[model samples]
Target: MNVCIEDCTPRSASVFSRSNLRLESTLQELSLYDFQVDLDQVGMVLAKMFETNPTIPGVILNHDSQFIGMISRRRFLEHLSRPYGRELFLPRSIRALYKLSQVELLILPGDTLIVDAARLAIMRSPEQIYEPIIVQISETDYRLLDTQQLLIFQSFIHQLATELLQEQTQSQLMQTEKLASLGQMVAGVAHEIRNPVGCIVGNTHCLTQYYEDIMQLINAYEQELITPRPSIEELKEDIDWEFLKNDGLQMLKSIQVSSEQLKHLVNSLRTFSHMENKQRRETDIHECLDSTLIILKNRLKVGIDVIKSYGNLPKFLGYSGLLSQVFMNLLANAIDALEETANHSHNTAKIWISTHVADSCPSQLRSLIIPPKNNPEYPQNTESSEDPLTPNSQYIVIRITDNGPGIPKEIQNRIFDNFFTTKSAEKGTGLGLAISHQIIYEKHGGCLHLLSTPGIGTEFEIVLPLI
Candidate 1:
């Protein structure tokens, strides 16, 4: 046997009242099935009703008590003013004036919430959004809801949602700015420390050579079987000359190695953070990729393989530092994808970087690049370029691909959207692809595109014009 359990706890009187109030609120409470005319009525019937009841904006219709359609006062006026329309239609029946092009009457049950009625009304066509929604009260009774009141209700909700989204965006930007400031501080400190570390490395090298020369002289003197003076012997024993000779050299070598490593790290940090220059210059983009790869070497050494297919191309004019940051972001993300792939299989994870030149049209390229959402802070460039990318123009396209779980098609259009991420909160800030998109399209006047298949892989293509 099944036993049923029910909640017997008492609820507050105010809560019960609120629930009762919500149940009683519906479209049926608005009005009744009046202000209607018959389809057989003369066309002048609508004009006469409008004159008699000037407050009513529209009238519904019925044929043998079957709902047919509705006509608004505004439309009736326009029809009457048309040349020869009054003479042609005013004396005719309502069926003669009715046209098939009119918007279909939207119907809803009387039990529908006002909010739901408003939502259904706005979902209609551009012309129909302002038309009254028919609320059915009974089998043969109905009511017309004013679209103006419904729209006003929706406008308030829309305004509230917009304000909330604005607040969220503002918070995201504040976090990004804090991170940016921290990165700048770190870069400044690294730059200041590099010079002193270089000096220490150079001095250690000299000391290592000097110590080696002293050891050589001592060995030569000892090989001749010349007895050291008592004072010298005591000094050697106190200093543990034999241990010092081996360990002292090892210490200097360790220091030198560590110093070199530190310098490389400092250089990598500088490369990743050095996007301050906004000027375009003639520089090798391959070198930028190489530097980025060097910085990511530690992460790539475990199970990842990077394959580069470089092509001979001219030095394109662009911001080297900004381009380097783009490469760094792409390569880093590729490595992350490969690492994720490695966790599931023993297969060798790989990333492919290739470059080539091709012909492209600016108009066609513009369609591929997603325009930025309306952001008042960063206004978009509305003017067309004088030197547009004609079909004859040569474009250098750089492709970065990774053999990993690809991005889903649903989110392909949003990969470059600001503050959008597939990664966890601790792993990403969601600005890498957004910044890269801006650097390529807004700054370099290039295009960024992505192609992906879920089971296959993901590829990003960056196209920059040669001219």
Candidate 2:
């Protein structure tokens, strides 16, 4: 049925006062109907309803006047063309039509914000389906609004949109806090893992040298035993020596390699976990880039090349460790993406990392004016300059670019969402970008965002304020 905004009545003074008052009210009147049809008759009923009234968007089905399920106009036509629909006629019961009515029944409290309901509807509805029906319930009796429901539904939808945006913003903040905590944990673990790994490497190297010397002695003994006049005593000693040398050497090498790998892992963990101390100090962006490259070098695939376009830049006051980690993750992901694309071809993969100072940087006078109690990292100082050329106005911009399959438009919106990933479980935790976003935004007072084309590639630009 066609719903119009003008016919619906506002329930309260607050209803008309809201910025998106119309959308808020629209959500209130959009209720589901408990209209049930047999499993066999669903297709016919749906087709007949829509054919009779092409404007009908959707309807809810009920069994024995009890809420059961609902169907949309678009889905009804699609169902009729399916194999299941061809086989069924006036089906004896609607029980078999469960597959046809794929719509999910959502129950919302009357007091719930209309914005939230609309978000749920948008998120859950299939690509080509009608907007979800909002079922308003009050004990046993319920009435479905027709054309009159449109205005109220529209108002509710607008309110819901505003609320959804706010929720998304809050979600981003929460994710940032979580990632900061995680980085702290990783840093601690990396610090702990590093010491033990160093010890293991040192010990293994010493043991390997000792084993090599023993092997040389065993070789000499074997040579004597194999001589024309072989001594039985020499043979016995040589036999045990050979076994000891071979096993000991192998074990030492294994330990050495394992220790090295553990060290690498620790380094990665340390980079990822460490938080930037807010105290703004002059820091070299090039050094951070170099450290990140060193850690990720081994992870890069053969034939993949990294190009650095670092400009002669002044050191800006900022957290170095956190920024290094951000670069590491972004660069690493770029390398991985290129490697993934290179898997099927012989093409060489390349990643570009660049850094420079922003020309028209804004002064941090406003930021500096705030008392130290407001920000532990950089306390307010009246001496700080308010001009663009002053140190306070200087800022750094870093860009990481990759030539891989670009992000799809559909999935790009949620790329920074927690647990959202295009990679398989083993390849990614999906937290890297999300964490990166937090680090750049919250920790460094920077911005991180993507620029891409479907087949061209993706570029992430990061902008940070220089103290």
Give the number of the best model, judged by TM-score.
1
TM-score of every candidate: 0.64, 0.47
Error of 1 at 37 (Å): 15
Q: Give the Cα lDDT of each candidate.
A: 0.73, 0.62
Clashes of 2: 25
Counting clashing residue pairs in each candidate, in order, gives 0, 25
Error of 2 at 63 (Å): 47
Q: Give candidate 1 regions above 4 Å deviation.
A: 1-103, 106-130, 134-146, 211-219, 226-254, 275-278, 311-316, 355-396
lDDT of 1 by residue, 1-467 (tens): 11111211222223333223332356665443257788788888778777866655577777877877777666777788889887866688877777722567888999887667787888888977777778788887656666875555445445655775787689768976885786688679779988988888798888888988988997898888677789988988999988888998899889888888777777767766665555777867787777778778889898788999999878988877678878878888888787777878666788999987776655655555554565543334423453334467888888899988888889987888777889998878788888888888777877677888996788888888877
Error of 1 at 228 (Å): 10
- Which window of 10 residues has the lowest lDDT sum in candidate 1? 1-10
